[model samples]
Target: MEDNYSLYEIAVCELIRRLSNKDDCKRYHEVLGYQHRLNHYIIKCRTHGEPKEFETQFNEIISQLNRVSLLELNVSFNDICNNVSREKQDDVVKQIPFIIVAMTQSEAAKLFENYNESEKLKLLIDSISKGRKTTHFIRQLIERYAETRNKWKPFEKDSRTISDIINDLLPKLIKILFPIREEEANIDLIPDYYESAFFSSNLEERSEIRDYFIQRDCIFIVDTISLFNPEIRDRFLQSQLAATKPIIGILPISKDSMAACEIIEESIKDKFEWVYERYQRKLEYNCSLEAYSLPSFNRWLYKILPDIVKRIPQAAPENINKMKENLKYNSKGFQKVVLSMGGAK
Candidate 1:
């Protein structure tokens, strides 16, 4: 049960455990091979069949696969959640702040503008200000503000003659909102404060902020692969991978298209494969560049549930039995699985 085991391996192990007779192992292996072949067939058939006919056949095959996979694994909802939590907690050295970096300066600017126009920044400020009278609140707020600006939007608008809105406003606001001690007020650190408290001053400033987070073991989550230009993507990959912290780059691909993966590989060359292989070995899941459809994801979930159940320490016998029963009936569709797991709120 090393964390490096893939979901596929976990599912296969669970399937082996559920076999009543040891002789059935060969039959089960053959079935698994058949299912793998079927997956490839379905992928191939996607380009050939007539729209309506293909849809019907695809749905049927997916449903059948889901059923067989669930029956073979026989896991519960509580078990899946418990295992996921345990795996997740193993990495929780601290609450690693996920800084989501956009693919381009324009996108980053848009996101930053959105935060200004929207209630996000206001809400964040309000939450931080409420019910806490700690001496470090101002420092915390400054750090958060600086981090957000650097991660989301490092480039200043060329059209703007003035500095950033937050940059111009913070000093005055800090003086008005925070009671400064006499000793603190006399210190001539306004220039240094401004430099440390704001981003968009220079490229180096942005990089410094990124390095700060990396040193703290923060996870940088890049938004999407579809939006990245070659230069931006390469720089991002270089910076993120060079860091001691973990990076989770989400490639939002179409249901059955490899365009995203192709674009990524084109951008980063063999580095894409290298990162993926590293993820598979260290992160306990395959981050291989592939177009993962909804059905494929669901099938994975179905297979892994039994292994998850086995990992949960406090699972009551009756509840575990009920979960297995639910899985037997509800594993046909992802929606059914959700509903079977107490309607999923």
Candidate 2:
């Protein structure tokens, strides 16, 4: 499956999606034209026989990438976390529509496990950041947890924040765990979120829909539990669109994934249209609501890519992290799962 990458096709579609906004992805129409035509050829490759004309499409991408200074649609953890204001985070989210990978509550919990911390943080960061990649910090992360010297105690709360970790958890753990000054005990840069931010049985619990700079590097439940409620639906939608931190709902490849978005119309009183496109090989699926759009088709391609989940590579930090940065999405539950894309960042 590692060899089954549709690299050219994915790159072209990603570029085209970046150019669509007309405001931020500013470039001559030629780049956009090639993207559309390239996507057309990709769909044709799916249906009809592969076209030799694909060479022309690939060539056009290379030329435009150089001339237009190829636009990469990415929002960093620092992009939102660096800013501590409601207005600034809102502006960032507004400028770049955050991607949501809708999935089940149990899946979120599985990812929440501490054993998966190293790989989980990498996957969430890359996906929410729209394939921003670059996860060299993972090696340091494993070392930091090793310094903890004790097992990660499961906190039974619904969620946690940077404030909770730094002010409370880290200090206590650092006394015995870290081998540095308390003030300068540099924590691993593996950003994280606790359990599902929207998971609740009642409106009281549900109303705590978190969205801010604090929630910037988080992954939580985006299941139907909160999606069907009117207020929760509206809040969740707003968070996805306006929060500096991306909230992609990575749903399983089931009807629930489809209904997750469709229920938006049922909860609200508007007619929301969801447009989706099937990428090459019928393997990847991407969708978005016209009223509330995300960055790109791949942003909505939330499925675990084939071959992304496999045995952990040898204990070499630099090569492993470089391999991981390319990966956009990876499912949890593997022994040590890390995300790796087909190319360099």
Candidate 3:
């Protein structure tokens, strides 16, 4: 981001985004039509209206945003109505800071700098509502994350082979995911691409890949961001019939949020009507999802490893302690990590 955008200013924009995002502002959409009007209003704030007037509609948003941040400011409603300048209306919010406002702009920037794509994604998702009571569901999501994959079939009598298509798609996959500067998310995309290729291969070929991974005790994972490939979608639908592997998917991005999220969603939205439908079914979707991420998944594994080791009652304490120091993860990893407490003494 440019220096012209202060972290405080960015946070304010983020608040603006949340108030208009499909996931966040369903309460306001039918009434305020934020979906269609938000960008127009942003432009209006610079021209026909002043910042103070712009914030007049944000009283409820201010209250809503208060729950997500660590701050609990007690600014009066009167202060919000007054004491705002055209150039620095966000200054008023300095007293009642939202997500990034709890700290100094510099402090917030430093904190944000360390956040990976998945972490930031989680933060943005969590900030949607004031509620924070889903720890158990999150644990379940992490458990599911350790076991997931997809399957695809090749086009009949196609001039090109499945491998040829995968070879072509591989370069494009790197090209898109590399634009993401966040290293963890970028690296995570590697397994997703290879997993997609594995699914797209013939049964014999896929079995080979599956055997190798199964022997190695590796789990295949798919995160947010699939391409606009119909074959992939059809393969996914076909695979779901007898699917033993439980899969968890995240919607690409809300209609708003980070600029990067919008770009990613827009590019692939056409191919993922199923995902978009899930977002549109917001309340139901929220009920089903527990918001798991890679870091949280690792933590879940670490937390459960001690109990898992207990299952191997005959195992040496030193060996069990060593295993606890470095936990392993995947579908098979989940099977091993989630062992029973009742065993031989």
- The most accurate candidate by lDDT is 1
Clashes of each: 1, 15, 0
* Residue 228 in candidate 3, Cα distance off native in Å: 4.2
Candidate 1 lDDT over 230-293, as tens digits, reads 4444555545532343334434334333443454545444445556555554553423233233
| Ranking 2 against 3 by TM-score, winner | 3
lDDT per model vs. reference: 0.37, 0.33, 0.33
lDDT of 3 by residue, 1-345 (tens): 234543343444444444443655555454244323434544567677577765664444455544443232333322322222122221110000000001122322333343344443345435422254445423322332212232111222233322233334433433342343221121111111235335545877655654444322222223333322233445444433112222234332333345535544554345444444454343332211121333332333233323323322243444543443333323222111111122123
Candidate 1 regions off by >4 Å?
1-95, 104-201, 238-244, 265-274, 280-345
RMSD of each: 25.3, 25.1, 28.6
TM-score per model over all chains: 0.28, 0.21, 0.23
**Candidate 1 residue pairs that clash:** 75-306
Candidate 1 yields a Cα-based lDDT of: 0.37
